[model samples]
Target chain A: MTTDSLKYLWQFALLCLLQVLIFNHLNLGGYVNPFPYIYLILILPISIGRIQLLLVGFLLGLTVDVFSDTGGLHAAATTLMAFYRPLYLKAQSPREGYESAAVPHIKTFGFAWFLPYAALMVIIHHTALFYLEVFRFSEFFHTLLKTLLSSTLTLAFIFLAEYLFVSTRRRR
Target chain B: MRNVLLFIYRNHVFFVFLLLEFVCFWLIVRNNNFHRGSVLSSSNRLVGNVYELNNNVTEYFRLKTVNEELALENAALRSLLNESKYISSGRKGEVKDSVARQHYTYIPAKVVNNSTDRRNNYLTINRGILQGVEPEMAVLSSEGIVGIVKDVSKNYASVISVLHQNSSISAKLKDSGYIGSLVWDGRDPQVAQLMDIPNHVELAEGMLIQTSGFSSMFPAGINIGKVKEFHVDEGDNFHSIDVELLTNMSTVSMVYVVDNLMRMEQIELEEQAQTDDD
Candidate 1:
């Protein structure tokens, strides 16, 4: 593997360790559940094949799911996200099939499309995750509130971590 | 052919999407089996071990906050002790022999792991079997009762917190003798519902509720909570009451574990009767 791929791999491993070691244990309240594990899927290199991205997303989510005892909830949500990447990218036509030469940073995806792109993905993933855990619509509003609160916290974590740790520069 | 493989590769994302969704749906359905396979099942040992590790690191950082809480709690406890003395002053009525007043002790156990985020929440405490803690023991804070232990291993035990939808505490109104089930609506932590009280009975806000000692799980007169709002449901015969729980379960640090001395004997007798009837 090249230095670029190696760094991405290391970053992925570090994110998993950080999430499982720290965030998984935090139930801030009935509403605030921080899900930093989504970082693994969020920052995958654009050069990777679409099918490969799907496989990687499933594995990343499955690993976190098994550890957190959330079973297939994460796997299901993340795989859906991986598959929808093309459609979302297609919607933001300027960033369509974003070349590997460019990073998936706020600069590359543009400010207009960046926040909603990440926010949409995070919202879908959190909704699916919290709903599957409850396994019922008996208290829809309550669980829906949990999903929204946690998704916002998760989005903040993702944006902050990317800004602080991940450089917005592509590898050669 | 090469062309077919290429075509399949091009559509791989769609195929994988369907594949994962199908598998996920199957597993989610399978996980619904009520007979077994819950948060603490034997099948969950691998995930359970991982959570135990995660809990260790998280709890380590919480030590400082926990100590501060404990200190404040201690000072409050001292005052409460003084109050108890004052209340029982000049009352020397014949008190029966009670091991509970003597041997029942409390050890501070911080909640190393908890799941208020989930509908059916489970709490993992730092203390376990090695610490003389056993299953079916009632765990509580200075405020009120939390829940009873349902499982135990050598080093750790998971508690089904009162916030769980499945939890049913036997609680009665302090002003009246009406007892009902205190259960969570799977929403707010501060609120829970006291169900099954008949509409004929008068219920009031801010009225205290205590355990009825109906179940071996908890002792009699343990403070549950006070009524927040209550009224008969539309066209219903029972009162649909909401309570503001006394214990702040979200931030509880040190807790007393209540053990019923004769619980084993009672369970054995009940089991024997059950077998005889069968």
Candidate 2:
């Protein structure tokens, strides 16, 4: 495989490890958790075929499940997310693509395009993950309260982490 | 054929989104029972690591609060020591001084993993089956009852937090002896509802609720929470009371898992009663 693809894949694996090894255990009170690492899947290079990118997301999430011993919970949620990555891309089509060598960011994608994109993706992932984990709606409203509130916090943390660590080197 | 192929490609993204959402939605709709698994859970190993890291950063933040609680407990213990002095020093011959001491032991444990953000949450402690802890043991902090031990491993055990939506405990008015199931509404950690307590029992907003000694999980008279708000359902005989939990679930750190020395006997008797009823 190409060096760039390999590098990104390595990055994805390491991030998944961090998520499973570190962040998965932090239950910071009720419905408050920091999960910025999922952004690795979100801001991956666009050069890879869309379908392949989706598969990789699925596999990445499944690997998290394996380490956490959560069986297929993360796997099923992530595979479905892999299927939807393109739509996230499409909704941000107003910008076409970031005109830089660096990956998309709030700085690159701009406030207008990036906010909706991040919010939508995080919601989708959180919804999938929470529902799969619970696998029930007996307390339908209670579960929904958790899914939405936790997802919002996760998305915000993703924003903060991206802003702090990602150094976008745009030569153009 | 070209038009059909192009149509599929054009809508591929939407189809993927639909499939993923549907799958996740299905998972939520299916799961019903709440069982035990502290190891592989929301505060799973990965989440545990984050909590450990966060614990470092916030450890300082909690030091003051923990110290205050510790001081309070120490004061309480010292007074108990004073009161029990008569019992010990009085029994000079037949009973040893140590034997006269109260054996209500408490083991300190760290919450390596805990989750309050989920619908049903649990906390994993560093001490477990090996540390004299066991399933059905009552877990508590200096504040009050944390939960019941659901599962245990060599060095770890998961506690079903009292905040959990499905969590049910026998509670009563500390004064009146009126009993009910303490149930969480899953909306707020500070608020839970006590059910099955008859309206005839007098209750005020600040009334203290404590474990009723009905279950082996929690010891009798352990402070639980206080009545926050209460209402009598029209035509119904029971009082639905909102209790404000005493423990700050947001920042639980150290806890004590209590093993009742006579829990087996209590549980066995209760089990036999159920069997007889059947």
| Best-performing candidate as measured by DockQ | 1
Interface RMSD of each: 3.0, 5.7
* DockQ (CA atoms), all models: 0.46, 0.22
- The CAPRI class of candidate 2 is incorrect
Question: Candidate 1, clashing residue pairs?
Answer: none
User: Per-residue CA lDDT of candidate 2, range B174-234, in tens?
Assistant: 9888889999866677788999998888888899999887887787899999999999999
Off by over 4 Å in 1: A2-6, A13-34, A49-55, A62-72, A86-103, A145-153, A166-172, B1-108, B115-118, B132-137, B150-153, B258-261, B268-278
Question: Interface RMSD, candidate 1?
Answer: 3.0
Error of 2 at B246 (Å): 1.7
